[model samples]
Target: MSEENKLSVLVVGGGGVGTIVAVNLEAGGHAKVTLVLRSNFSKVSRDGFSIRSVDHGNLNGWRPHEVVDQVPAIGFGKPGFDTVVCCTKNIQDSTPSIEELIRPAVTPGYTTVVLIQNGLNIELPLVAQFPQNVILSGVSFMGSHEPEPGIIEHDFEDKLVVGAFRNPGTSAALSNARARDFVGHYSAGGKTVCEYTADANRSRWEKLVYNATMNPICAILRTDTATLRLSDSIENLVRPAMEEIRAAASANGYNLDASIAQRMIDMDPMEIFFKPSMCMDALKGNLIEFENLVGEPLRAGKKHGVAMPVLTVIYDMCKMLQWQLKAAREGRSQEDMLKVYDSGKP
Candidate 1:
């Protein structure tokens, strides 16, 4: 294919997942790929991005066609990106908001927005704003992280589940061509497993069963998934929270089987040992993604009148912990913050 005829893609966030996608797309040599990185732009520009992965092998100095600081820097000069992949954390209070971050790249008529984010209802805002854009909801089970500024340590798993949003006003065929072509780009290498589903909402709920249960437990307990899986937390806390999530999804017109919880629990110990994003955020003093993961689902349960007592308690603990972290960052010492945080405790 001629260079002009090939797809032009822009990947936002430049984190673990972003680096993985950018590297693979460039390796495929089938698309015009550009990456938008913030602080790591200088390091990545100088040394390129490195990926240490069990699946993809050790790769160093992986460079894309172009690197920019933000979306506006990419002057696509046409309708902007044909495909925009978002790999950032879905923090509600983020300065760019997810909407603002992708606004510059998305072309209303043709761009396909791939949301590789976690939590429930994350695509709502984008779907509402860009009704004309083809929106694909994706759930990434890939284990990867940026240990430092420009290096990604990928443990395993390349399974990315993607599906179109069945919005009432949007046509299912709106960006079908772009979505299929984008998926084809990943089909070349056997290293990555990309599954295209008809129902992305169901996929999101399925991933949520595990994320909602383990992420908060790890964060609040200051432990890792391995520890949570081996302890009473699984039976007493994890299982019950999973059930609540299942119930909430069902109430929202999505059926999540009881087996998902066990399936996630049965994941290999290697995955269990790693810290989830929420736990890492808490430890790093970054804003925890409580709203989408816990708070949003809890609110949905209330709206549907479904009882989520187990999840409610877990949600409260996560919220309290987030506030405590915030207090610590606001110049209060950990000891003073803990005293105030635990004031009503026995």
Candidate 2:
């Protein structure tokens, strides 16, 4: 497809990362960026979104050409987007709804589905739905959030690595070319986009290691990345968890070096203050993506005879925390559980 024929783009999630990406795409001069919000978020009309990025300075006011709750029945009808970026959280129960929302934009020979979310499990299901078309998976290190409806705050500035997971070998030939082209376009327009490894599994595993180590701990303690990075007690807990993730990744045929984990932990702690997305979800009383981020890796590790006691403990704790938080949000008493975490009784 010629560059001119490429539909601007459609971003499915209207949360922090979604809004930031959409804003960046538009600011970079990509006009066809359409943000698809949930039907409940219909309040986010064509006025688009207002975003504030620490790195980009300020995007006080920004709007897209269209903002729809559901995909139009016409299936990429008029303002068809060349790329459909999925930034939804990985909640198993919500998969069907998300799939339905994604279907309309998957018109053959026109659009590519680029998933930019946490966890590694979303690739297969997404591909199962759109086999012939190009399905790309990406890992983002940027930290973003929506402080309120139609408003986003970008706290961290990081690079993005996009590639194909089904056929890792062919990712370079099949997706990298297009990815590079998109990256170049975005970069020219002042967005930070880069082509990292063609190996999606390795890339995903790398990010998983970082997530598994930081997200749960931060969520459980209600702290930011810096706290985790600076605290010896947190490090004691995080180091072991990261080690287990490394074991899991190694067992699953990915040769993740020990230094990768060290490098992630060793990064400057003060650069970013935003908490992990999982932590943010927990704060909002929303279900966390524990299964994919933590549970799946542990299961994969166990299947390969890898021991992950630290991860196992954190996983259980996070599950309980999520349950307690949900119950509290629903007006149930979580006093019993809070006593444990609050009084250091656990």
Candidate 3:
């Protein structure tokens, strides 16, 4: 594609998932990615990004087409993004609401918004806020992390599944066309794998079989996947929770195979000590993604009258632990976790 034909893309979220997407798009030369960053903003903008990946090899001082801290509020006479790929964690009612954060760069009828995030039912808030834009649902399976500022380590091959999230008052043609265009640019480099799915939500539910089970268990247990793999709790704990998730998905009309729960566990490479995002967040005292990841799905399943006893137990612990982390962040005692029922306490 020529320079003018290149897609104008905005990437928010600078973690493993976001960095991989930005670097690959820049490498492909099909998209001009303007990455909005935090934490590593100074280091990356000054020295560019130093990336090490199993697929693309190691890159030193690699910069996207445009690297900015903010997307710049857009209005008449101002440009907006052609595609906004939000790779941030789903933390709505958590902090830095993705809807408000990316509002400035979203053009009502022009910009195609892609959510490369986790958690079930995460599309609703963005949909409610940006009803006029074409929103695509994306799910990524990869092992990548920023071990240090401006330095990325990607050990697993990145794979993506994208499809259009149902947008009210928008034609199916427009949504599907934009999703196809995104896959083209994403796969132009031919390094990472990007696949198109007719129903993006099925993929998310399948992924949640792992995310809602293994992720939160590892967080609550304060262990890594490698450790869990070696433990006898696979049948006793993890798989039961996963079965609940699959049942929950089925209750909601997304029928997953009975084997998906076990497949997610067996697929992870044995050598790597895979620390999921929730586990890492717990270690760092950050807010665990309970609401979207566990809470919403649990509620949905219960509403459908699916008995998810194992998952329900996991959800309660996740919410309490999440509260403790937030309380600690606010300098409140962990003992105050139940005080929320008394009055306005956080």
| Number of the top-ranking candidate, with lDDT as the measure | 3
Name the 10 consecutive residues with the lowest summed lDDT in model 1. Answer: 72-81
How many residue pairs of model 2 clash at the backbone? 0
Candidate 3, which segments miss by more than 4 Å at Cα?
Answer: 333-346
Q: Candidate 3 on 242-335: residue-level lDDT in tens?
A: 8888888899899999889779998777787777889999998878877788888789899999998998899889878987787788997645
**lDDT score for candidate 2 against the true structure:** 0.73
lDDT of each residue in 1-346, candidate 2, tens digit only: 3446535788888887877777666666644677778732655674556777865767655666667777654453464567888888887555465657788776655577788887867776666666666767778888777777777778778467877657332344667666665665455456575565567778888988878768888888888778777778545888788888998998899988878877877654566665787788888777788877888888889999998999988889988987776677667556866776799954
lDDT-better candidate, 2 vs 3: 3
Error of 3 at 81 (Å): 1.0
Global local distance difference test of model 3: 0.86
Q: Write the per-residue lDDT of candidate 1 for residues 1-346, one digit (tens) a residue.
A: 5788767889898988888887777666677788989979999999998879766788888778888887863355554777888988887666878888788777775678888888888878988888777788778888888879999998867788878875555688764555566677865566788877877788888888878878888888888888887778889888888888889999999987778889887764755586788999898887788888898888988899989998888889988988777777787886876788799687
Q: Considering only N, C-alpha and C atoms within 3 Å, which residue pairs clash in candidate 1?
A: none
Q: Can you list the residue pairs that collide in candidate 2?
A: none
Candidate with better TM-score, 1 vs 2: 1
